[model samples]
Target: MCGIIGYVGADGALPIVATGLKNLEYRGYDSAGIALNNGTVDVFKQSGEIDDLTLPAEHSATCGIGHTRWSTHGQPTDANAHPHTDESGDVAVVHNGIIDNYESLKSELSSHTFTSETDTEVIPHLVEEHLSDGDDLLSAVEATIERLEGSFAIAVTTSGQDGFVVARQDSPLVLGHGEDGNFVASDVTAFLEHTREVSYLEDGDVALVTGADVTVYHDGGTVDRPVQTVDWEADAAEKGGYDHYMLKEIHEQPQALRQTLSGRLDTVTGDVDLELDLPEQYLNSLEEIQVVACGTSNHAGQYAARLLEQFADVRTTVEVASEYEFRGGRDPWRTLVVAVTQSGETADTLSAMRRAASAGARTLAVTNVVGSTAAREADDVVYIRAGPEIGVAATKTFAAQVATLTMLTVYVGRQRGALSGDRASTLLENLRRLPGAIQQVLDEEDATREVAYDLIDSDGFFFVGRHLGWPVAMEGALKLKEISYINAEGFAAGELKHGTLALVTEDTPVLAVLTDGAKPDQTLNNVKEVESRGAPVIGVSSLDDTTKYLDVEFAVPDLGTLEPLVANVFLQLFAYHVADALGRSIDKPRNLAKSVTVE
Candidate 1:
């Protein structure tokens, strides 16, 4: 993963690119660099945080491109930092993804000298060759892209060129139109502070930015891309009153879930009108459902897998997107592949969805981003509608994803004659109650904070659950370890004694999801097992009279099968408070990116 920020305006370049780099640092912070064109191109870069990259206090240049990298090709170093330039340093480039044919391209360009071991260096040299042949900046970059093979979002600026050229194939790039400037970045947040009027560039799209204006080209012809104002304001990206974006997002879950459920659910008739393109014939013949995702998305897929199987009676399986194989003796035409990604640029998820698509499986993208690659390429898309999640550690998006997939499940089940009207009605009713249930949990944050403070010194944490609660437990552990950096693991309640019991100690706190639908009675046995070893048990329970068993109990309001998902808010608050207590970088944890754009 990497970040790209490019600007062409009347103002100085250094401050614009520098501030943009800091704003997008969460995307990639390993190494940072900026290439400015002030009659002559000058590059400033370092293999450290954005703050470590020294730059001129003031620059007269009106255009520049910057990059923050999360090392894909070369290791993070000053030489490996981007804005990789040509021999004369006249042509500079900043890229967000990998160059698949760099070795071959590097061998071909034997006359040119390379300073870094990065694949991105090939581009500037290729552009330099094109420019030396009397090609213009846009033509040079277009020619350079012809020789390049792989997923990349590139921004190139030349000393002699009045503007910069940008192109994207697989990685994301957004164009922002501001009052006095035009911007190019990997995401909206990179330039959200300057402008909300933006347009998403699709695959094979290229653009040139010059002095408050942008011209886009696709398929060798000029294209007029529609520019729309973003829904959320610049200040929404800020932490607001919270200590970290993670905490703010954790508390924003109720509103986020409501947004997901809004205008989609019909509680009376149990009908879910997502208005998808999937036909009744297709839904009737859909024999298998494959959910493809990575990391937290994979956990959400796991949760959705259970729901799909139960609701639609479909043979459903969850696969970590990278490891997904499309051909497995299954009838592709009868299979439905669901790609779940919060940021639709996850390379592995896109690759997996592509494989499934090429095999003839109808693919659906369930994502929060509106114009993301997944949304653009999928056969159909269901928006999660959780607007503007800025936390590197996902909170509201996870709940929103689960809710959206549940609605999809209901829709499919109704179409396939798997779910009765009463059954769907019941599920919809419970789904509608989700936000209120989570709010009840959010109200108990003070108690959850106390639990976090008490367990702050623990050696490790164990999250255990069963049934629908399984993925919730896994997600709970993921949140704690991601932000707090605690040694946390989640397991099926029945599996704790298989081999995990040996690791339990008095210093370890067991977080048991003993809710109404999680098979609480069986999980209580594991709770007793951990309690026998003197481990403190923090139970998320709906069952009454569990006071004697749990060391710290967070009562979950009953929402039937959805109660386990409700318990997740407490876990999020617990992780936030623990990370806060340890003075951790909860928003941007070390060595983690919000979007993984490289496979």
Candidate 2:
């Protein structure tokens, strides 16, 4: 939702901090600011895009921190932009996440003069009140983190101190070590130009950086964290002539899917091996299953639930993560809980998994992140191997989740003797063909992107499908709304007449996933319902005979059963392109965060 960068070096700090913030512009922000540690703390803030703010020549310093914020608690304004200062204007803070208890903190600090309408302002003052006479910067930070509530990745500088004190909880922060000094940023890209080596700070960790050394602490004790060497070239974060990251990501899908499936699916074994070393009997004995997630991952869970029920014969239920903990507490035991999260730190999903685990049910986490809390806490973990998905509206991760879950379905089904050897092998072969099928769809980007362009001026989108494809339609609507900011709804093809058909008008565009592998005639009948209303229909399917109802046909690969899953990747690109064309922020749409780490 926000980007943070901090640097301490022999060179001046504003240029280094600004360059870091510029590199992180793809994350999306409503405003930008920086705090420089000259003799006294100097802060400059602006209420617009990072590029819109001009760097001042007089702001000279050797240490500094910068921020690009997506507003959550307050409206975007110059005063509300970060690098917020203490009431006395001695300490300054740049924060990348929500401060959940800010209201209480704000009321408590009402006796002191306040300047900005921001939760972030509470941070500087909290530090102001807590920094002891003899305490070091790290101790002050640790003390502040304990007092605060909700997620945050904060970098602070004080007039009394010489270096920056950085802390992270729920929000992400990393330390970048360089030749002349040390740095901190929300993600590795913030300092990629200067250093590829980065140490990801876990929740409740604090880092204190001097010009020559970087030290980290956790729970009031000093600790050494491992540095994760990023595989991507620095240029991967830069747009290689592409207009936007969303566009680049759309084009990168073919390679992305190949990367995701590389070593995960083994054809010779006739099993989609996650290699997760769980008891086969444990999976075979599952009487019921619950799929928990939010946003795009939730849509993937919908499809996964169907696949689990169909292949493994496990009764499956899909629930939105925030509601799942309360709703699922009433479900019986012996039920396997599967939590899907691309980042793994999704707050609601994590909470739901914890509640389920505490209730004595075996829990599994399906995600792309390797060390995310979901991976750390789950009884078993299946990494999608999608590799650093930066775009906020998920592309490869969605496809990878579907592919990984499909394999898990087959694995569980095989364990329970639910499917014959020939059937399982055939399904695995179809699964292996998905990456190429998606590549075929990727080649047709011009056609799909054109449809997105035509719908850019429209206010609403309707996606309709049936059976397994029904969830795909809902996911398509979600992707469109997530990035494009359009009003989108998905309905079962047959259920459109039940109430939703009235929303379909000639000006509205209706996307129909007509590739009803299981219910072809019913899907066609559903398409006819929207077409009769004169709504423009974009049919996404592998079937060749869709000439009757479709205004524009987005043809997918002929992988048969696997096409329903692969078709989702194409819809995501369509949504992304539409949003990009509308000049919407595709990566961090207003009021949305990539990881909803707080409720």
Candidate 3:
């Protein structure tokens, strides 16, 4: 996904636009560009990071639009960057999603001269054609959008036009309300430094923004959108004192978990007061639970599925969102399809949720964003109240998702009478102390970092666990490979003899997660198998006895079934330190973006 920002204000637009692009760099982009509208549109572009771009010393333009592009239709080149313009160079457009029918549209406009290899080039030309046919700027943009196909969040500005037009169809776009100016951007972070108030644009909506006002339209009718204030402070997006945002976010997990659990749990009554408006009849429907997610969120879903099945006594299944198909075979009436996502804008997860809805399943979204597509489309929604997570490899949100789902398990168990009062009280009390437990892990970061230093030169890494530890193992492998670029694999301890054992070598460090609920002795036997092959063992456990078998041991707080969650923080630190040592990009890993908005 790319980032787009536009501003119509009295301040120098170029500087503001450039700062916004820098804020969005975590989205992962290869090129950056900006278009300034003074007496005429002046476009500047580069084929590298946003920081590499240079602006004119002084420009009279007070309005402009900018883009940080992740190449899709064309390779990463200056010509392929955004702020594409028409032949006259009067109109400039910065777009975010794909134009699915660009080839046919290009063929239809054979007489037009194209300067760039991008699907976005057709947009400005089409708008120019409409303007030549006696349409105003607003009408031209609206007509151009009608002819285009597929997802897009586009911002268009012309030299002589008094305002800019932005449209959204199946992509994210938000408007910022400011006293000195009006702004449009792909994400709230782009404009958070300028304004906290924003209005989210829905699918098939168009808006025209001027220096002083903003007007929105949906289906040819004028509409008034709600203005919501962002809760995250502007400094929250900044790296306070840490060397990298990834490390800073890793340290923020304890506070994030505390915020997630605050005031929501009633330990006195052992009740979870989620306050979600789902009817009791829907909650009482006894059948099955299906969780759909992608990547790290899918791992969280796997952990939640195990807890839901164990605590709620419900038949639960976890499916990767990209591979889930909701065709007409299964009875969806009694199924609750839970969509788990951090941004809530993942393309695959959104498609999966739509299919589940079409199949008559009761859909619920567990996501972090308040106005995300998944939050708006699902039958019911629960916010994972984990404040903004900026790192490309997720840290805080993963912990928050698992914690929230654990609480959801408690709620379901209460509704189904699966857990008695005393047992529920005990679980709730443990949940209340989870933040302190995780804080204990955070306090032991120096030890984890030391372990990371010890295993920095490992040829490869293998992670193994059982039961709830299995998902923790998977997450640990994912974090290490994503950030450190290490060759790593995670397996159930029992699966080692099947095929994974062959890959174990003396140079490969085997990381074993030995927690309370996961059969510790069985995993210990698996550890022995790897040890016999001369593979070094690094044990992550709360127990003291397991350290005897390990060359190095990382201790986590002993929280019974909750130990796996705390153990994850140590693994996250290990990956961060390893990546930092290797001089890898810890915040923005290569070839990976923060949100998978495109398929």
Estimate every model's Cα lDDT from 0 to 1: 0.87, 0.79, 0.85
Q: Quote model 2's TM-score.
A: 0.62
Q: Write the per-residue lDDT of candidate 1 for residues 1-599, one digit (tens) a residue.
A: 57899988888878888989898876677789999998899999999889999998888898999998866455578998998999999999999766767888999999999999898999999999999999999988888898887667999999877879999986778899989989999877778888889998988988988985799998789998899887665444444336677887787787667657755788999999675868899889988999999988898899889889988999998999999999679999899999999988899999999999999899999987655799889999887867567789999999999999989999999999999999999999999999899988888889888889988999999999998788989999999999899899987999999999999999999999989779998999889999999999999999987888889888999898888899888888998999999999888899999999999
Question: For candidate 3, lDDT tens digit of each residue in 380-426?
Answer: 88877665677899999999999899889888888888977777778
**Model 1 steric clash pairs:** none
TM-score of every model? 0.63, 0.62, 0.63
Candidate 2, residues 241-325: lDDT per residue as tens digits?
A: 3656666666656555554455445466566656577676776677788899998899889888887887778889999998886
Q: Candidates 1 and 3: which is better by lDDT?
A: 1
Candidate 2 weakest lDDT stretch, 10 residues: 325-334
Q: What is the lDDT of residue 25 in candidate 2?
A: 77
Better of 2 and 3 by TM-score: 3
Top-scoring candidate (lDDT): 1
TM-score (C-alpha, index-matched) for candidate 3: 0.63
